[model samples]
Target chain A: MNEVLTLKNVTKSFHQKTAVDDISFTIGKGEVVAILGPNGAGKTTTISMILGLFKPSAGEVRIFNHLPQEKQVREKIGTMLQEVSVMPGLKVQEILELIRSYYPHPLPMSELISLTGLTGEELKTRAEKLSGGQKRRLSFALALAGNPELIIFDEPTVGMDISSRSRFWQTVDSFAAQGKTIIFSTHYLQEADDVADRILLFKDGTIVADGTPAQIKSQIAKPSVSFIVDPETSLEKLYLHTEIDDIYRKNNRVYVQSSNTDRVLELIFQEKLAVRDIQIERGKLEEVYEELTRGTKEAV
Target chain B: MKIFQMQCKMEIVRVLRNRYFVFWSLVMPILFYYIFTNVVNTNPQDEAAWQAHYLMSMTVFSVMGSSMMTLGIRMVQERLQGWSTFMRITPLSDSVYFAAQMVGQSVIHLFSITIIFIAGALINNIALTAIEWVMSGLWILLGSLPFLAIGTLIGLMKKVETAAGVSNVLYMVLAVSGGLWMPLEIMPKVMQNVAQWLPSYHYGNGVWEIVRGGAPEWKNILLLVTYLVLFMVLSKYIRRKQEVA
Candidate 1:
């Protein structure tokens, strides 16, 4: 696959502070990459640089072998920024039609409405009158209107409800199935884990970890077992087991963290511990992300 | 070209739908024209010339109000709402976007000119040849460029309320101080000196000359052009600074 986006040691600084430190990455055609980080971690800054909103203080960014700001290159890119930006006093169809006119080829208005889940009455409503989730849906529709080859979303699901978020992901999934390049920045770890083929974990002003979701989870390999137990049970006795790394109680449940789940289970059975609704789970991306970012912060 | 047309149509639709803008730009000018010509200056020795002058003044006022207030306030709102940033990332050219805005303002401006002219002819009995009418209208349209640039400059302000306040103050100052609301001869001598330096004064003088069936003063036209160029350059600089920040 061709390289749809390439960043070579790109850096962006605003006065005394650097928003994006030296960063380099490449996204191939049809790849779904998520930039995951907490607030002020430079995820938006990096996306801005890629979208040609700001020039990198150093190094270079190229999209489709051309500068991102070039008209030809921008024509092939669509974006739904963190900010809701629809024009006020214009009907939804009017705004969509205006945006659609900017591209050489665009999706039909009917198709766009259906894809974004905009209802019939919404077509005549003013852009400013839409609710938060509806506005997000409209923004998504605009992003897809251009029939772009690469779509960049910055916190695309920030204000959406559960059903809207699921619908949004389903739309994204369908778009990705068409082999289009997709890049999004988000703080939702599960969002990244669920949809992204690759994740770039950002900390401070740089990427701390970059890999598939499973690979990132494996970096913190300790598995955990937890279950509800009687509040009176003396779970403190399990702390003496050498194989169990840690034990804690919360509410009416006990949690055991161990490197080997088999040994922990054997010990639990031998001790005749009363447990119900037990669940054994591997390290989650959220835990791995916390450890990586927190660990780096302490190291500094 | 098609994109430009579509953008212009959208902008025009938005401005036309705004009740505040339409009332100020379209309705208020005609009201002011009627009150000033009929009530304030009822029995002038040269009724025809006096009526024509006020007509031209009100037309200039209307164009300035529409171009500056409508365009400036809308641009400020767009920036605050992130629409400007969205446009920056699109494939649309900046020139096309600005041209569309200017075209929309000019449409409202032309409407103001027509309504004020109709009020002047019907109620005040001001008469002019077809050629004089066309020339005066053309001069008024040309004189509006500086205000358009000024509106863009004001639009660069961070807050919509601040921009609106500043634009209102500037509008009143230009109208009164520039002698668009009254003749400089009737005002104090010091006021006339200050009026001579105002671009609005030069714009009013050029349009007034055309309304009186005379050629536009080259010096005043030149001054208006200079202010237009200066404001355009300053507006561009401010916009670039904003984008970088």
Candidate 2:
């Protein structure tokens, strides 16, 4: 795999607080990696360092074998930051033209309009006058204007509506299919689970886990058997087994969390507990994300 | 070169679309020129020389407002709104971006100066030799450097609200103290002393001398240069501090 980005022990500190601790990772070409974390988990800080907005306090970041701040690297990289703001007075079309002019080889206007789903009327309107959704679409279009080899998005879907959000992912899907290296940080766990080839789970300025979605979920998230039990039945006998990792109740259903659901099932039957509607719940990405990010010790 | 042109073109478009620029730079100066010279009729001496002098004053007034208010406020707003951050990641270098901004605002300043000079000619029929007209306009253009530097300093402010407030107060105080609205001769003795130390005064004095059949004094030129250097260095230092923070 061709390496598109590499961070070696890169760290960023602001005043008294260290935002990104010493961390290293390399992303290859055509990989769609999701950086997932709660707010202030150094996600934005890391993205800023990658985009050359902030210099690392220690270590190095290289893109395409060059410093990120170099012009050669900037030409190949495109980004949409968390805040969406365009130049105030120019029409959308004019602003697009200005930004496109900065690149050596820009995407043709027709393709940019088609990909971003910007209407003719919206393009004619002044940028500051556009609705919130229109602004995001325009920002997305600007990110793609350079026809960059590497694209970075920080919270790309924060203010997007349902339809726009789906459209955004669809465009990203097509880009990924075209062998573009994409990196994004998102609060939507489902988006990460569905879209990312690999997840870099971050907590407290460090990567707590990094792997394929299936590998991460299987490694940390435990499967569980959930059942509707009678109110009077005691679940104390089920807890005596060391195989059970946890037990909890929600919506009047008792969930027995363990890696081996069959053993839990047999234990339940042997106890002759009056339980019905029994179902097994596979470990999900959301649970893995929660366990890792919430700093829980339940993961084996 | 092409990128610089595009950036400058878009910046000009942005400033032209601004309502405040239209109001403060164009309309207000013309109105003040008409009211002060014609309505109030305070010359009490050679009306033509007074008209020409006040014309220089209003022209400087307009240029100063655009520099401090339009350029300064827009800079702060752009930085605060994340537009500047977005530009940083692009292939556009920071020097090119800053140059484009300064060039764009200068073009608007030229437009403002031309409009007020034309208004002075029509309203009061104030006429000068071709050399006087050309020289005065050239001096005003060159002498506005200090005010532009001041505008850049205001742009360094973190908050748009604070920048706007500061620009307004600075613009008004400088204009009044420098005798752009009225002559320093009739003002209090202390104000006359205060005007000598201000860039606005030197900026107007250069043009005033040009329209009065004399070249700009070396002292006026030298003082304006000093102010320009001082403000630019101050702005650069503040910018370095901001980047560190």
Candidate 3:
């Protein structure tokens, strides 16, 4: 099947500053793709272009084989923008009703009220009276209200407590389970690591890295080792000092990194190092993100 | 039609919930009308001309307050609060959104005018013929168009808070200049000239004159229509700037 969402060579600029440059990718139906990047990394800008909130300076974006400029195409998509600008006078229930009137087949209000986790008193209160987290939840509720096939969240869980964020991911997972397509944008790498099928990282207004969580981890500079040793034989000296790339010690725990592992293991056995505990450190998505942003050839 | 109705209903409900509606629509118009009526006494017995003058001023004042202050403030607030963003981006088209707003605000403005007109007749003892009353209502509706455009533009141009304040000042200034409170015949020439330029003046005069058994002239109607179209065009231009960028 054609990907549920696609952008081919999309570039968007604000004034003279290029916010999103020549970026292209696609996400299939039922797949959760995370757009991961730091501040000003064009993640939000990229999503805005997809939503048709802003016209792209270059290139085209399509959601479900239709441009957002088409009204019929918009009905197939739901969006929670980075900024929540809902009317303050509207209560959560009232807001839901208002949105419900627009789309012919909206999600049941009660179902959505619960899916968003809004409680009794909160549901009746005006939007301005809502707490920040409640506001975010309500915004998401509006996005989901129309029961569109595709939902795009722009940094949805920011400032939310861990529990709320976790609940949010569960909600997303359930949506994905039902074969709904999702595109999530967030700076929280851990969240992306947990939920994303594919994580696309943008830096300098262009996408620099795109891969699955496990695949991205493989790009880390070097493997690491950490252990507590009783006898202080310099690992560098014992291993011919050539395999050691870097060493850090604190609280009587030693951490070391190197590309070579054979010499290090030989030294560990020969010295009979009284190792309390040993762990081979596999690089995390965070480490790979750092490496990608460190003037990697891919970023350029 | 579905989108239009939905938008209109939403605008009506949203306006009903606004704090500014409490102050502008409910509180301020009645207060201003009561105070202005108190300052002048139109003898009921023989000086029917003076009574006519009093009734006209009061009715026109009601229209002035409802259309300018009420509509302008609400539009500006909707613009600033990002309420327009939701409506603006909707597939129904921005013109549909504006149509809904106009319909919603017209209903609201009419409601306020009715209540205030009743209070004027019963409580303030302003006299009017049934024909005159119907004519006044018609003129009031016609007078509302320019302010509707002005409010729309202001809402589109200014952020919410600034729009509210700007609209309030503009309303009051136009209310006074439009001769809603006093007789333009007795006012200084410059102020009269300024009043002539304001659409509120035509609405106030047309409604007030119609209420006093005078003819509703076409000049004010023409001027009001001209100003309304001009403001609508100006707002459309401003929106075009957003569209291109």
Candidate 4:
């Protein structure tokens, strides 16, 4: 596999707080990877380091074997930051032309328009006069203007309407079809599940999970059985089974997390623990996300 | 080269489309010139020299307004809005961006100067040799370097409102104290003495000498250049400090 980006034990800190801690991930050509995290989880900081907007406090970042700040790397990478900002007075078309001029061989204006789905009237409108959705489209057009081999988007669909969001993903799909490597950070888990070939889940500035969407889901999303239990009923014997993954009490209900819920249920009866209102939960991606990221385990 | 030209062209378009710039830099200065020279003070000994001198004053007034209010404020707004961050990720080098802004602003300064000079010619028949017109215009154009530096320095500010407020106060104080709004001859002794030290006063002084059939004083030229270097160095220092912070 051809590596398009490489980060080796990269760390970024601001003041006394670390933003990204000892993260190292290499992305191959044509790979579509998503960085998933909750707020303040260092996704933006990691992306900024990759784009050379912020210097890493430790370790190294490279693009195509050159430093991220090198002219060669800059020429081959395009980005749209989380904030949808544009030059205030120039028309959309003019902004596009100006950005395209920075590249040696830019995409044709017509192709950019087609890719970003910008209308003729939108193109003529000044940037300050653009509606939020229109400004997002213009930002997308600017990102694609360079025809870069590697594209990074920081929360790219943040303020887009549903239709605009779908169109933006469609454009990404076509770009990926062209074998362009893409890295994006997003809050929407379903979008990552649908779009990304791999997911890097972050928590507290460290990647807690990295795998394919299915692998992550299966690894953490164990089926569980829950039932209301009496307060004095000690559930200690259930802990002897290795098939059970975890156990926690919420309200008067005790949830037994395990791949083998039948065994857990049998153990409850075998131990003669006073329990009632039994229910079972199937594994899900959202649950896995919540479990890994929340990082709170109430062992009882 | 093509990229630089394209960036410059866009900067021109951006400035021209700004109504604030058009109103303050072009319209307000011309209005002040007519009001000060004709409406307020009708008679002065050697009216042509007074007309020419006041013309340079308004020219300085116009260019300074653009440099401080338009250029500086817009830069602050862009940085605040993350447009500067976006540009940094591009292949566009910082040197190229800075050069484009300087050249674009110089072109704008030249435009306003020609308009005000033409307005002076029409209103008061403020006649001088063709070379006088060209030399004074050149001095005004080049002498604005310090004001442009101050504009960039103002851009290092964090907030748009703060930058706008500071530039507004600075613009008025510099214009009045440098004797651009009124002649130092009519002002108090303290102000006259203060004007001797201001870059704005020296900027107008160079053009004033050229219109009076003489070259700019070496002192004025050296002072303007020194201020330009000083402000630029200060801006660089602040920018570095900001990056560290």
DockQ of each: 0.82, 0.87, 0.46, 0.87
Better of 3 and 4 by TM-score: 4
Q: Name model 4 segments beyond 4 Å from true.
A: A226-240, A249-254, A262-280, A295-300
Report the number of the highest-TM-score candidate: 2
Q: Model 2: clashing residue pairs?
A: none
lDDT of 3 by residue, B1-245 (tens): 77678678777777777776757666665675566456556333545445455555655555555556656666665556555555444455656766787798887767766776676677556667778777777777667777777766666646656766777788778877877766787799999988887787887777656755788688878988899889889988997996676
**Model 2: chain A TM-score against the true structure:** 0.93
Model 1 chain A TM-score equals: 0.83
- Best model number under lDDT: 2
| Angstrom error at residue A261, model 1 | 2.9
lDDT by residue for model 1 (B44-162), tens: 77877888888898888888887788888998999889888888888998889988888877876776778778877898777799898888888898789999999988888889889
Give the DockQ-based CAPRI class for model 2: high
lDDT of each residue in B1-245, candidate 2, tens digit only: 99999899888989999999999999999999999888996855788899999989999999988988898888898888899999999999999998999899888888888888888899999989988988888887888888889999999987988999999999999999999998899999999999999989888998889888998889899999999999999999998997777
Superior by lDDT: candidate 1 or candidate 3: 1
Q: For candidate 4, lDDT tens digit of each residue in B140-193? A: 888888999999998888899999999999999999999998888989999999
The list of candidate 2 runs beyond 4 A from truth reads A230-242, A295-300
Ten residues in a row with the worst lDDT in model 1 chain B? B36-45
Give the CA lDDT, 0 to 100, for residue B204 in model 1: 91
